[model samples]
Target: MLRTLTRQSPLFTSSVRGFKTSAAAFVKAGDSVPSLTLHENSPGNTVDLAEETKTGKYVIIGVPGAYSPACSASHVPGYISRGGELAAKGVDGVFVVAVNDSFVTKAWGAELTQGKDSKVPVRFIADHAGDFATKWDVLFDASKFFGNKRSKRYAAVVENGKVQNAWIEPDSTGLDVSTAEKVVGQL
Candidate 1:
């Protein structure tokens, strides 16, 4: 009888696994942000994410790496190309966040924006030490990926510091749910 009950309880068995094995990612709509104090690439300014989102609406776009194919070719460009439209649609701030250091983010920004003064008008920031990624629970082991930890592809739209929408990828590096088009639709 005891063995049958134990085998029957899938929910109970899963509850014990906790954060490590769960495919279901955390951040959900209406959840308050965890922290601020992130590093931006340009001029090396340290930004407080919470403070920046206070204006109106903010979009946090996370990618596996700064210069990865999907990220550079599509993920970022999708946002960069539409930055004006998004802003015109009434978004206050749009940020691209990656797990790499600030320098890489800056360079990636330049490349994506075509070396203009500010091609996208979006801030390209780095989450050094994986602080932001960890807080958001989107950080993943990427030892084989460019020799470092990396952020899983995801996007969040925040309003007044609360998440209005969260689209986390099922596969750590997949871009299905977190694409710019999806985020824009949410906005």
Candidate 2:
């Protein structure tokens, strides 16, 4: 049989799949945050992020877990320390959501913000069974590490119930694009 292609054949193309440095994330600007019943401080206190942000601007930061290493040491603290700066950027409030129970979230929030300048009043919330993350399509199977599903680290600027901007860590657990400094600087 005769081979149709040669080294200089125009029909020949690389076999490697196409790769893009910046892939389109599941969350994007203009996406509406789901109106789910999330717990705040306790199960009795229910909050709907969509409803809360429907009439104002807010920053929603989703972490993999409430007391995880990155979340406790750097991620949450960064936002707490720079709360004033975030407020100056027109962000009405900043909420940290984790796929943990309200009790854990409440304690973690208090510990993280104990002596910090809470200019923007970062509200730590319990995503409560990863409902928010699943609805928003930011849930990932972290079973190997977390032993359960978890939310991807993301920072979104919501205005009038719509996402004005978002930065989701492509790897789901990294502390890069979703870092407080980067998100705040852009805003």
Among these predictions, the greatest TM-score belongs to 2
Off by over 4 Å in 1: 1-25, 42-44, 115-120
- Candidate 1 residue 22 C-alpha distance from true site, Å: 5.8
For model 2, what is the C-alpha lDDT against the true structure?
A: 0.87
Please write out the lDDT profile of model 1 over residues 19-71, one tens digit for every residue: 55556556789877766678887436888787777667788888889889999
Candidate 2 residue-wise lDDT, 35-122, digit = tens: 9999999999999998888987888999999889998888878888887888888878888999989999999998888877768878
Give TM-scores for every candidate, taking all chains together and pairing residue i with residue i: 0.80, 0.85
- Collision count of model 2: 0
Supply the TM-score for candidate 2. Answer: 0.85
**Of the candidates shown, which would achieve the greatest lDDT relative to the real structure?**
2
After TM-score superposition, what is the CA distance of residue 186 in candidate 2 from its true location, in Å? 0.7
Give all candidates' CA lDDT scores. Answer: 0.80, 0.87
Residue 157 error for model 1, in Å? Answer: 0.6
User: How badly does each model clash, as a count of residue pairs?
Assistant: 0, 0
Worst 10 residues of 1 by lDDT: 112-121
